[model samples]
Target: MHNSHIFDKTVLREYDIRGVINQTLNQNDAYVLGQLLGLIVLDKHGTKVCVGFDGRESSPFLCEKLSDGFTSVGIDVINIGCVPTPLLYFSSFFFNADAGVVVTGSHNPSKYNGFKISLNNKPFFGEDIKNLGIISKNYSYVKKSGNKIYKNISNEYIQRILKDFNGNKKLRVVWDPANGSGGKIISDLVKFLPGEHYVINSDIDGTFPNHHPDPTKNENLKQIIIEIQEKKADFGFAFDGDGDRLVVVDSNGNALLGDQLLLILAESVLEDHPGGTIIADVKSSQILFDKIQILGGIPIMYKTGHSNIKKKIHETGAVLAGEMSGHVFFADKYYGFDDAIYAATRFLSIFSSKTQNLTEIISRLPKVFNTPEIRFFCNDSEKFEVISNIRSRLISSEYKVNDIDGLRVTTPSGWWLLRASNTEPALVARCEADTLEHLNQMVSILSYELSLNNIKLPISF
Candidate 1:
């Protein structure tokens, strides 16, 4: 039997192991990963692990190989079958496992499949990921067969998610799971929720026949928008492939941005935990942070990745935290992990308590014009360099900049962000302003900066 193997360097990402199946990731890679993770868990005095997979074509085969490898190392495995990423995270706490791994590609396309891991409920990332590479190159293990037990905790998960649903409104709601892992959970959840529910694409289809599972792009949310408008529902909710991120559509079929949703949720949280610290990624609108201050809550800007934000929330004891990508973490009355299903319940509870509709509530907030996150191809090798150059230039010119993750520069009119995507070989950019004219100017500034680096801003802008 082989004792060592090297992984594709590209798959060892900062946050998780991920790559296109068959091409960059294969069963052997999964087996090796299982072995490496098993060794790590054993070292930490942990005897059991929770394993789960999403509704991806390659997920089952990969999961089996992973389990085989884990068992070969005498590590007991608690298999949770196919489920959303949040459920996998939840399994860690429910089973009291020392470690956990989920076979999922998250918001990536259907052809891609990989893993997200947690150790003792903490996200295993950054240097922890790098250490996997070093261990895989040379490691020794005694092969003693362990046990694998299958567990179906979906009902318990559903019950826990509904436990926080305090909404008494019988409002009509539309749910679109995009045929991903969250479909079954949402299908089961609506039965208990006190609302007129219409669910679309709840069938588990690995092919994702309807559309791409990502909700961040408005294009993917088209179906939900139409359903909400045609059905005249109070609102709608959409989920990404792994169901951790959320996209909400109002009664007018308008999809709310991640920051907007954060602002809405913060309003309720701040009331309960007065003078509490609420965290948001740097990409969030300035208006969100300003409003937090107005609500008598402390607002902190942090790095963009979910792992980064989650860790920050834990370290600071913050009541709530979120990313512009729709990953919201709540420490109040729930685990401090992003669970879109739970978030949906909380949102409904808050909305039911109010008399005004979603659109009206949104209208009352300060207005700001901003571009959706724009991503352009940039080689992984050079993406960081490009951001560094821009950061240096901005600082030399005495521009107010936040470099927590990348460069978020503030100007007289508004602010702009240029950051390298941690999960893809692309540079992500966004800009915001109080007026259309100022928004255009901010975009122009962003474009000019990219031009200096021999990169063209996406022409669609």
Candidate 2:
């Protein structure tokens, strides 16, 4: 109980701790996390801690080991059993816990798993995450025994989400949890709704039997599209692996990216609270910002990642925030964390209470050409330096560059963005233009800049 355990340095990231489970992460790492995270809570004047885990195959083993570490350190632990990350966050408030931790891989492949920690009800990330590695590697925990108990908040969580479902219209819909942790939650949720509903892959399978459980990839959503079209459903929704992210499929089976969904959600949030500030990640389309402004809500673009957006919302008092990867946060009437299940319910409520022309509404937005986020290989150590060098080059050429998150250049054609991803060993770039030719040109500029750093842009993402 008094020996330090050094973790795989690569697992500690800016947003959350993640890595390929057995390869870079194992039971010892999980135990170290519990001890270190529990110490953080105690140091911050906290006592009780809530713990939850996803349906990943390795999640249960990690969860048990982590709980042992917490109890070994005299941190009272409340085990919520298998649940989505959002529900774990909710447990913090419902049980008045000092901190919360959830074992989830998010949208990564099944081989991946990690922990997301929340201290004092706020996200414990950035320097705090890195410090976990630093501190755990240096010293060990004191030997102390604590208590452990189990609590089930599933019924309460389901009912609380349904309380706000006072929609005017009832439309048939298809729900897909992608066989992740949210499967049971969705299965329970649809029964109480007014609309006729059909759910696919509702079994909580950590192996992700149906598709990879990632809705962002178009292929994973194809079956849901077919289900929606054949069932004559109004709209379809899908969740990422851990149920913290969501993707929407229109009636025509067209998938609307997160940027488009944020614009639509703005219509609902701004109608009730006009002139409120709304936040989106830097990679969002310019149209989204303009639309939010037009809707009478101020739009602020911050760095990508749910943790960053959550912190930005708390600091700026923004009513809503979302990322292109489908992590939507709502601070208006609920906790300001990325809860895909909650976001789906809110969107349904808005769909029924608000206008019915969902397709037409999105189509009416001003048309602009853009390329999907293009990710290219880059070393973790050099990606930031590459971006820095690229920024210097852009500045020397007098190009308008916004380096808020990474390097976003405003050009006559449109805006091109290049930023190092927080989660992976790669650089992400996006381009937007009024025309296809201009879009290509902007991408070419990004490519040329990367070439200068001896990095070649991938052919496509």
Give me the candidate number with maximum lDDT. Answer: 1
Error of 2 at 187 (Å): 0.9
Residue-level lDDT tens digits of model 1 in 1-461: 44979898889999999988999999999999999999898998889999999999899999999998899898999999999999999999999999999999888888889999889998899999989988899888999899999999999999898888786878899999899999999999999988699999999888899999999888898899989889999999999989999988999888888889999999999899999999999899999999999999999999998999888978999999988888989888888998898898899989877888898998898988998888889998999999998987888775689899889999888999999998789999999999999999999998999999999999786
**Clash count for each candidate, listed in order shown:** 0, 0
lDDT of 1: 0.91
TM-score of 2: 0.97
Count of backbone collisions within predicted model 1: 0
TM per candidate comes to 0.97, 0.97
TM for candidate 1 is 0.97
